[model samples]
Target: MASPASQDIKSIGIWIRVSTEDQVRGESPEHHEQRARAYAELKGWHVAEVYRLDAVSGKSVMAHPIAKRMLTDIRTGAITGLVFSKLARLARNTKELLEFAEVFRACNADMISLAESIDTSTPAGRLFFTMIAAMAQWEREEIADRVKASIPIRAKLGKPIGGAAPYGYRWRDKKLEVDTEAAPVRVLAYELFAEHQRKKTVARILNERGYRTRNGASFSDGAVGRMIEDPTAKGLYRANYTTVGESGAGWQLKPEDEWIWTPVEPIVSEELWERCNGLLAARATGRRPAKKTSYLFAGFAVCECGAKMYVPARRGKYVCAACLNKIPVDDLETLYRSELADFLLSPEEMSAHHAAANEMLREKELLIDAAESELKKIVGSENELFDLYHAGALNKVDFGRRHKPLSERRAQIEDELPRLEAERDVLKIGMLSRDEVLEDAKDLSDKWPDLPWEHRRQIVETITDRIVIGKEGVEIILLQVPFGNDDELATKPLGPRFRGDERY
Candidate 1:
């Protein structure tokens, strides 16, 4: 039965995303498009657009250009609903599916999946959306965890987990073996360095003799040093020794206890390799001085004249070489601690935020419930109209007139429920996040002095954007907290400057 309420659904977009494998198996994009169009026709909706993600992987589609365009249309109300063959065809990643649902619901748009019989415009369909999305997410996480756990076991067994073979070696039949051409050059690098007692001399000798790296580039001094130091040449190959760091910190070496070493075919004797590396180690030690102790606010503190402040050896203060301005390191840390205490949100403020968020969510929930109840009433009334018509008490025209408005209202309510529920979900997330953020800030403030030097530096880098030392006093500018919008919250002076402070 075509409800008059479906007339409100003006335009719908057909999502035809078929992977290459699916297409090869006879599930063509045209086949999916035809099926989606039929569903739109059945709903009395016009197919105004077709979003085709042909031959695209469903593993992660959000970052795709076509996916971004489709999201823009949903937000702009260009299409009221999206029709697809199934949820898996829409997205394989669980998180992306939920994101799609939220976007559709928030826009008062519907998602129709023919294979799953899912229509988000209905109350039952809305509930199924949440449950199905959760199940999918759980399944994906389980698979990911299993894969992560197997990595260490594979490393211990000397199996290739999945990375390119190291230089001067190749994986043949899943076993590591020395490359015929590169192995000789690698061994020569160690021998030449030990003979000449100079890294650059070895590199120059290799290049002048027409020898090149694996990439066909002329050998460099640093390349020679690394090649001589690698233990793979001496038969013992190390695995699971390094990992990627946070925020582009680059690769970092793992602890020695976690490192796994497997004996491989040697290109050079262990004694020869160790002798070459010993020379390089001695050169490094003799040339470079010991590193100075790093202060907490080394990079963050800036002089009033816009120059970076530095701490000289045993000076215990940040000195600006340009304008000759200086501030004691201890005093600056005290001011930072005091300013951080003031930055924390009060208990009453947190309570007010939570109360407002909860109240708003409650209003949306009540609206969804009321609409669901009204939809039931509309269904009952339609059944009564059918009975009256069958009993010959009413003519066909009279029955149609009475049924049209009720059908329209029922359709409208079904559409309204999902939108209300989506908004409520968004509010709930924000409210919960604020509470956690405020709690973390409180913990950091109370335990400032107890934190380690490295931990304190990380905290300062995350929260404090910059610190300015002026002739008047020091000003600490902090980044915006989750509860507030202002990013540059400058504080008053905590104390006076140190003795013998020079002004510009």
Candidate 2:
């Protein structure tokens, strides 16, 4: 039904829904909200509220909380009218549509479909509602048909669908490819599974190596086991059926031999994949015992005081052997957490720093161009020297001496070019915006103790070349490089310091 043009629409309610199943789909809830608001404004309707539901099914309106509230608002005369992106979004079932229509009629509110152009205020609009509802049903059926058609084609082509990518491989451009950086970690998983027949042990090994999921999160034992059993690593895709439900008695796994063998860039050999699965099965059937460990940071933490931080024979405290810094484990944890909050720069300081750095980069680019031109002139002179020698215009000894010096000069210029280029790139990055610098500073400071010693050393080296601890405090000396003979470039600090209590 079309709404009466003369009917006043004082307030409107917008409902936006996004199914969790379609979470990976491009459009977000925010996008839907924006569209709804714009449509409401175009109609001169004042938006009263917006109801958003995530990961909820659209098939049944009764199952959704927001859908129930929308119905209640219609019954209580709270909203003058309700607006949705489309009719199917409001209700998928025709019977539910009739129920909502009754509520709208009783509350003196009208139902409007922005996309369908169906309003309940006129007889012609009433006739259009039935057609719009029918069309919505047809559109859904067509979508279902298309999905069904595509699934078979995808399955026949041996393409993975509706699940996360297998370990050691990432999904890209609609195909699976070997993740180079993660290949080594995959190998380690296979080795642990085959040798020790242990899932927890493999997880520990991966954790120690700093290997994480695509989201940079840790994996559980079941996740590791799933990775080992996945057939994709062996360049095959099996269409095995596994029932999903609550009762263990009802669900069973069924093998399908007509498995698709897709050509995937294998991360490990077929033999290794099989061996790991076999060992994993053996362990699952009680053929192997689990290993135990007491130290959480066994292979992860390190002392910065040029000492090997070790757990003493007694317990509960970590001690640095070289510096004799006997810091309790709790103290170290406290320091890590406290320092992060203290050392980061404020947002305002970072913004100013970034602007200054950008200005420096622009100046550096001009200097580099001038230096390159000067270097090119020197190269031309060297070419002239070579030409004279080749024409027998100069003696061999003279030519050799002249060529050697020119060659040395060319090499020097070539080396300097790289340095200048590096300086330019760094300067082009400019100073960190206050937020960015603070974020990074927090990460470094917060995770210092938990970080592996090597990573800690790198962070320290990046920020400061040397740290001399005094009775009063610590003196941090940064590594400042001279850009060139220019006094201005040579004198500047590579990085600005965030003194303990100073704003970023």
Candidate 3:
């Protein structure tokens, strides 16, 4: 039963979207469009236009050109009823789905999903749409988490986990197989890089010698550097090498130990890889690359004014271009390591924190049990009311009056149950292993001078958000990642990480 306005709207727009070409046997774009058309015909509505977003991933709504055009048309009220084969085809995420709903509602357009029989013209249908959209997003995130979790499992079993096969290898029969043509190029690239101690020189040599990458592209210095530095080139798998970055900063590199490593069929010997990397490291510090003084934290460090820190050739001073903030490289590294050393909780503090977590967990469990008991009591009351109504103990109006509040309370508790259960899991807190932090921090703080600049950089990158060089002093923001909350870890200390010598 449509509204008079909706029934009078004869022209309906059909939207068909599929993420990949590998759709189910009868789930092609044509099949979906046909279904929408059939549904429109049954409603006695004419087809306005078929909007097909073929082979478009629903991950991003704005990425597809047709989707943008469709939304623009929606905003302009060009279409009456906007119809889709399925909700997932409309959008993958809840926020995007809600935005679509808002746009449609604003344009006074109805949205119809044929597969789910959801018509936004009805209140219940709108509610169902929101719930389904949220459920779909949660399911997607859970599936992605499971997939990401399986990466280390795959690596442990010595399997390649969905990255491009290294330059010298190709995936064959679900394994890394040495590429005959490209293997020699990888070998030669390393040999040249080791001898020449430069990626540009190796790139030129490889190109001049008619050697190219697996993609048949001429070797660029960056490409050559990547090939030489990659552990995958020497037949090793790397997992968990990335960590969540600061807001708006993308993923950052983690410590080497955080990265899971497994062996693969060796393309080059470990000795050769070591020699090449060692030579590469020697060049990183000892030699000036492209007439620029390469600071250990060049790209990794930022200033208070939010500009990148760079080292000038003359004075070994790390200067911020925007604010002219300066700090000596040695002093900056020392202050950073000192701040990091203080990150680990003491033995007594950690013990107390663990105790608090256990108590909190127990309290949460009891609270959930109490909530569930109350919910069950309400259910029992509702059943009693229904029984009375059936037995002529109450009139229909009275029955409705008694049932509404009970139903709302039941719905509220039912909705809250999942969140409460999730909180319980989140509260299943683990003790921060001070020893783990101590070993790494101690090594970085006390033993860094003996280590190479490359090793030092790798260690520094593991926990540093960025070194903000303020006029007051250098501010070091360490990546804490507090066990229960992420925001708790984002704090900066009251004072400078440490002060440095006066600017030259």
Alpha carbon lDDT at 149, candidate 1 = 79
lDDT of 3 by residue, 141-211 (tens): 56456656786888899975756777887777645678887888898888887678779999999889888
Candidate 2 regions off by >4 Å?
1-348, 359-371, 423-472, 475-504
Which lDDT tens digits does candidate 2 get at residues 170-284?
Answer: 7686556787877778778887777766788888878887888667889678878988888777665334355544666685554322323344566677557745654554454
- Using alpha carbons, what is the TM-score of model 1? 0.32
Residue pairs in collision within model 2: 1-119, 1-120, 1-125, 1-126, 2-119, 2-125, 20-55, 345-504, 346-504, 350-434
Candidates sorted by lDDT, best first: 1, 3, 2
Every candidate's lDDT:
0.67, 0.54, 0.62
TM-score of structure candidate 3: 0.33
Give the best candidate by lDDT.
Answer: 1
Candidate 3 ranges with C-alpha deviation above 4 Å: 1-190, 193-294, 298-300, 312-315, 342-435, 439-444, 452-455, 481-497, 500-504
Residues 1-504 of candidate 1 have per-residue lDDT tens digits of 122222223467888898999988866576567656655543335676889998999998977777876766565445667888789988998767876875575455678776665665443355565775576556545644655577689889987665556668887865579999889888888888878878899999999999998789999998888788788887756777888988869998786546555556889875576556545655654421112227888766789899878787798888888887888888778778766665564566446545555666666667768877887788889999999999999999999999999988877775555445444443443334344445676766678889888567646644454688887777775422223322212223322342334422
Worst 10 residues of 3 by lDDT: 426-435
